[model samples]
Target: MNFGTLYRKSAFTDNPKGGNPAGVWVGETLPSGDVMQRIAAEVGYSETAFMAPTTGYYRTVRYYSPEMEVTFCGHATIAAGIVLGETEGDGKYQLTTAAGEVSVIVQNEGGVREAALTSVEPKYTGASDVLINEVLSALGWQPSDLDGSIPPARAYAGAWHLVLAVNDQNRLAKLNYDFERLKTIMLREGLTTLQLVWRESADVFHSRNPFPVGGVVEDPATGAAAAALGGYLREAELITVPATILIRQGEAMGRPSRLTVEIPATGGIVVKGTAVPIETE
Candidate 1:
């Protein structure tokens, strides 16, 4: 199928070698859904962002994984923002996604480009004991493996994620779960991912996301989950308002990624990261 300019970018890392790779397709008009899905499957990334220019500074954006279209994707959005900056100059661009209207800011800092996205208003719900137990069993984790301080919850910014905080960093490191089992549970619960985390400090966290729904075994840096986490913390009154937290992910997978999250006293969460072009054949 014929297409417009396509760029391969690695988001959340200044270095192309260290972040999650995503395909960014910029076109005057979006292709058909089937075509987009085919291209996304061919690109074989966690997600591919398709952007089409609209009236004024606004753009219509859609995210597709290898398997299906997702409501929103953070890393791909960052990559798309950087691409838009390079093409249209750096500034805030309005994006219309399935979730809602979102704003992304792209700017060059210290000769490196970075993008920050403001998520939709966050909301969350407590995870039922039965659901939590089912997930833990699928993950082969026992009740003692959890951090009693941070209770399990289902959080949403642009998508739904199961927030599970473990007690130790070591437990977080050894991530081995039954993919099909977890996938079944996630599908049944309408979960996009399992946000597995270990709190290193008050402002620092280590995360690992199992994205069986997206046809990805693990996501290196999950922007949606990160935003959801910020919302969950605020809703639970676990962190101070106007907090800036750092999330380190994809480390164990060898593609270390960093996401900076800004949690305000109220309203949407802000997540920032950098994206660099990746050379592809």
Candidate 2:
């Protein structure tokens, strides 16, 4: 069957070239898992979002990659929101996802239409060095490459991630890994992506994500990971409560994404970004 209309938007960055680009499929109904996976692989974006309206104002959504389906995706959600703002009008849209019902606030400001998605309840747990070692081995990185401040954690918002902070920027850039091995470990651990980060400044972070489990090598911008990082910072008491942090990602791959994360003492996190439509020939 011919696929429905699709929109390509780069989430997190205002410009089309920047941010994590996502393919959004909007229609009365989404395709089957196999079809969606095939389409996602054909689209070649890290993640593609599919949406169908629910009973009320809420919409049911799902995310797919070249290989499989994921519980949730932050960048794709943002991209869907921007599409809604233009097509469905600017306002709040409630989405029913596999994870939970998430609310997106859509608004157009200064010619930029953006969406801020409130995540599901975020939580973090301490990870053992043994588990971290498995990931390090697959990534061909040493334990010393990590920054000792945050420690390693299995963080979750809408999806699960391993948050690894590298001490040196160079370590973050040289991302060569055994994809199959990492995918096996991540699947066993029930992880969606491995969040690799380097702090560029006090409030700014440069990040990368290895998403082998999802059939993608890396994610330029990860909203779910950003929310998980905010939760980790709060749970570990690494940052001040009720703080706002900026995450810069995808620069290594030349697709820059900027995610704004808001952390409160206790609550679900808010990940904000803009999605611009990318014309396809």
TM-scores, all candidates, are 0.97, 0.94
lDDT of each: 0.93, 0.88
Question: In model 2, which regions exceed 4 Å deviation?
Answer: 1-3, 54-56
Find the candidate with the highest lDDT and give its number.
1
Tens digits of per-residue lDDT for model 2 on 97-154? Answer: 8899899999988988879999898988988888999999999999989999868899
Prediction 2 global C-alpha lDDT: 0.88
Q: How close to the true structure is residue 31 of candidate 2, measured as C-alpha lDDT?
A: 81
Q: How many backbone clashes does candidate 2 have?
A: 1
Write one digit per residue (lDDT tens) for candidate 1, span 47-91. Answer: 999998622479999999998898989999999998988889899
Query: In angstroms, how far off is 277's CA in candidate 2?
Result: 1.6
RMSD to truth, every model: 1.2, 1.8
- Clashing residue pairs in candidate 2 (N, C-alpha, C atoms within 3 angstroms): 19-256
